[model samples]
Target: MQDHIVVLTGAGISAESGLSTFRDNGGLWEQHSVYDVATPEAFARNQELVLRFYNDRRRQLASAQPNRAHQLLAELEQRYRVTVVTQNVDDLHERGGASNVIHLHGELTKARSSKYPELVYDIGYRDINPGDTCDRGAQLRPHIVWFGEEVPMLDKAAEVVRTADHLLIVGTSLQVYPAAGLVYEVDRDVPITVIDPGEPASVSRARFIRKGAVEGVAEWVAHYL
Candidate 1:
């Protein structure tokens, strides 16, 4: 049986494929304040603004393609039991052919009912307007784990990490909590590799590949695997 290989990804990986992080280049996401579009208070004050912001993000996601790092990870699944736990809201991993993926930051291609969060719908290239409603007749909102919301998948992700024979982390700064803390969940004896251009925050023993996502992941995989 192949050893379970759990990989955790963040903005850096997707940024290689043209996806920008909310904190990139001086702490701003898409030239707008993160508070204006990503907070529940912002949504309450101006739903239209919030909806349009995500709509724009959705359009950008539609335009971007999976990069080398994404493709390589997909190929790794051929050799290992791969499970991708990503903080990206985009569907790049799925598009890149990663079969098992968990989105910690929710997804861009989905919308849920305001009344019932479970009533989510797959929205492909469609705009979520103000009047969009579910069976309960409540407005629809982006299926995203916005600021201040609890990540429902944290426990499951922790369990996955705890059992991994190898842990591969790519493109994240290890600054964000909950998701960032997950690295500690892996068995200390299990080997861990982190690939990134900038030096990511670390807890002793992680082998760091200091390079961009594509180059770093490829190099690390070649040297170690």
Candidate 2:
């Protein structure tokens, strides 16, 4: 079997593609507070506001193209079994030509029934309005893991990390919970490389490349054994 390379990505990867991150400042998401747009309570309180916010984000994501870092990581599939565990909601990785992606937070191209989390559908770049409904007539919401919700894919992500022969973490500061905890699941001997601006919390044994995603990842992967 080909050696596995588990890649953990965060907003910092997409930042190179011109996408903005929500955590750069305290809880403010696109000028709105996290409580105003990223939580179930917010969605429950103002569905229209939440829908509009995501609609704007979906539109921006539609215009955003995959950057060099995204493309390079996808290209790694030629020599190794590459699996991407992304905290980002965008589809840049898939658009960059990578197969085998696991969205740890959720995906922006999908909509799930408010009543049944299992009922999810591909929404592409379309806007979900107030009248949108699922098969059971339940309202449709973004298929995202919000602030107060549980991460359904965390276990699978942990499993993937545990099986990896190599690990690459890009763009994330390793501050996000549950996802951050995943690094601890890696076998101590597995080598890790972190590429980001801020200081990422230390993993088992990491090689830090403090630069933007494209430059840093390109530099490292160039001579990767």
Candidate 3:
């Protein structure tokens, strides 16, 4: 059997594809505080603003091409069992040819029913208007794991991490809760590598490559693949 290689990615990886990171503008996105546009309360108070924010993000994602870092990880599948667990909402990893991916923060290209989380649809960069309704006649919301909302995929991600023969964390600072805690799930004996320009405090035992995603991943591929 091919050795399982679990990869944990964040906004840093997608940033190379021209997508902006969440904390780029001093904890603001598009001049709005995260709480103003990325929380369940924000959606409840002003659905129009919240929808508009995600609509813009969807358009940005549509224009972004997967960068070399994303492609390198996909190429690793030829020799290893690769599974990507990404905090990014964009589809760059999939576009880069990764067949197996778990979106921890939800997907920008999809929408879910306000009433039923299971009722999701692929909207694919289409603007979600205020009145856009789901199949059950409820308003459709961005399928994002907004602040104050439980992450539905957290358990599955931990399980995936536990099975990793090797773990690679790219482009994340490991500051976010739940997701940051995943690195602890790997067995102590498993090899861990962290590739990012900034140091992630959580993974002290990991071999750190202090470089941007594209450069860092390239260095990793040269040594491993």
Candidate 4:
């Protein structure tokens, strides 16, 4: 049986593909504070503004392409049992050919019924208007797990991390809660590698490759693949 290789990725990997990071522009996303557009309260205060914000992001994602780092991880599936656990809402990993991925933060390509979270619909890159409703006649909202919301996939992600024979962390600062804590779930004996341009806190024992995702992943591939 092939060794299980679990990869944890973040916004920094997608930043190379021209997507904006959450911390960019003085913590403002597209000139709007995260509190103004990324919370359920914000959505309640101004549904149109929230909808427009995500619509813009969806349009941007439509133009973005998967970078080399995404491709490299997918390529690793040929030799290892690869499972990607990503904090990013983008679909680049899937588009790059990764067969198994767990989106910790939800997806931009889908919408869920505000009244029934289980009623999710795949909407592709299309803009969701104020009147968009699910079959149950409830307002449709972005499938994204907004700030102040629970990360439903956290437990499953931890389970995957615990089974990893090899753990790779790329492009995250390891500053976010729940997701950051996942690194500790891997067995102490498992080989761990972190690829990022900046120093991510909390994983002192993991081998560090201080380069951007594309370059760092390439280096890891050369050594391990």
Candidate 5:
């Protein structure tokens, strides 16, 4: 068995395949505010609007493909104990062949009961419309962990980071909390490699690859691995 390897991914990785970011240079989504669509209050106020936003996301995910970075990460699984802790809701990491993945934000291909967190269902190609109810007569909601929702996987992700021998950070601003704090959980001695176009704020000293996800990651991995 190889030493532990932990990877953290975010929207930038998926953006390589043409997916949109939540905020891009003061984009519409930023102005619209995630609070209006990504909060429990928003959903409670207008379920239809919330459902449509996710439906649009789901459809976009259907058309997007994994990029070179995703492929390279998956290839690492062959020789290393790779654990992907992603903030992204997409399945590209898995689609590109990564074996062990923990999605902190929840998955788009799944839905959970509004009344019960454990009652989750996989709805690969189906649309989640209003009034869709679970067996217990509870409404079904998107599996996403909204802004105010507790990130259940955060503790598990921290444990993964603590055991890692090496850390790979890809395509995130390191601004989002909890998920971003995971970098601090890594053993101080462990080496870190951050691949991104911009300078990232890392917990420890990190070797920066100043390029976008696809181009930078493929070239860097080829040189290092």
Candidate 6:
């Protein structure tokens, strides 16, 4: 049986591909908080604003290419059963040759009906305008797991982690809750490895690679070759 390798990725992984984090916008707009743009309350306040925000993000994602870390993980599928659980909403993993990927925060390339979340459609890199509606006649919202929204795939991710023979954590600070808890869910005997430039907040079991995601994952995977 092929060893199951589960990789947990965060914004750091996508950052290497030039994906911008919401850390600072330099007051270019109205100085809206990240929560102001990512929460249900925000969407309720301005539907067009929310839709436009996601539309731009989807477009930006379309222009990004998956980095070395992403492609290497895909190659690992040949040697072991690989499952990628990423906090990123971009589709770069699939484009980078990874066969199986779980988007913990949902996907930017999809939209769903406001009345029925199950009625999701792959919108690709298209903009999701306020006028877009589902079959139910409700406005289409980004399929993202927004702030204060439940992460629908949390349980599924934990289940995948529980089965891992080897675990790799990349580009995450382990500050995000629930997803961060996945580290504790792995079997005690399972070996864990973490690759990040900064010191991770809390990952006691894994061996550390103090480098950027692409360089770190590449270095670590090389040892196995």
Residue-pair clashes per candidate, as listed? 0, 0, 0, 0, 0, 0
Candidate 3 global CA lDDT score: 0.92
Best candidate (score: lDDT): 4
Query: What count of clashes does model 5 give?
Result: 0
The per-model lDDT (C-alpha) reads 0.89, 0.92, 0.92, 0.94, 0.87, 0.88
In candidate 2, what residue range of length 10 has the lowest lDDT sum?
22-31
Q: lDDT (0-100) at residue 23 of candidate 5?
A: 64
TM-score of each candidate? Answer: 0.96, 0.97, 0.97, 0.97, 0.95, 0.95
lDDT of 1 by residue, 17-73 (tens): 887677778434758877888988888989999999889889989999999889888
Best-to-worst order by TM-score is 4, 3, 2, 1, 5, 6
lDDT of 4 by residue, 1-225 (tens): 999999999988999998988875543466897888999999999999999989999999999999999999999989999999999999999999999999999999999998899999999999999989999999999999999999999999999999999999999999998899999999989999999998688586799999999999999999996
After superposition, candidate 3 runs with Cα above 4 Å error: 25-27
Q: Candidate 2 on 1-225: residue-level lDDT in tens? A: 899999999999998898888878632365898898889999999999999989988999999999999999999999989999999999999999999999999999999999988999999999999989999999999999999899999999999999999888999989999899988888988988899978788765698999989998899789684
Candidate 2 vs. truth: CA RMSD?
Answer: 1.4
CA displacement after TM-score superposition, residue 152 of candidate 3 (Å): 0.4
Model 5 misplacement above 4 A: 26-28
Using TM-score as the yardstick, the better of models 3 and 6 is 3
As for lDDT, the candidate ahead, 4 or 5, is 4
Q: Estimate, for each residue in 1-225, the C-alpha lDDT of model 5 and write its tens digit.
A: 697889999888999887888866754386566877899999899899888888888888889898888999999888789999999998899899999999999999899998988999998747899989888988898999999899999999999999999888899989888799998898889989888887667555888887898887788678767
Off by over 4 Å in 1: none
The 10-residue segment of model 4 with minimum total lDDT is 22-31
- Model 3 root-mean-square deviation: 1.2
Model 3 pairs in collision: none
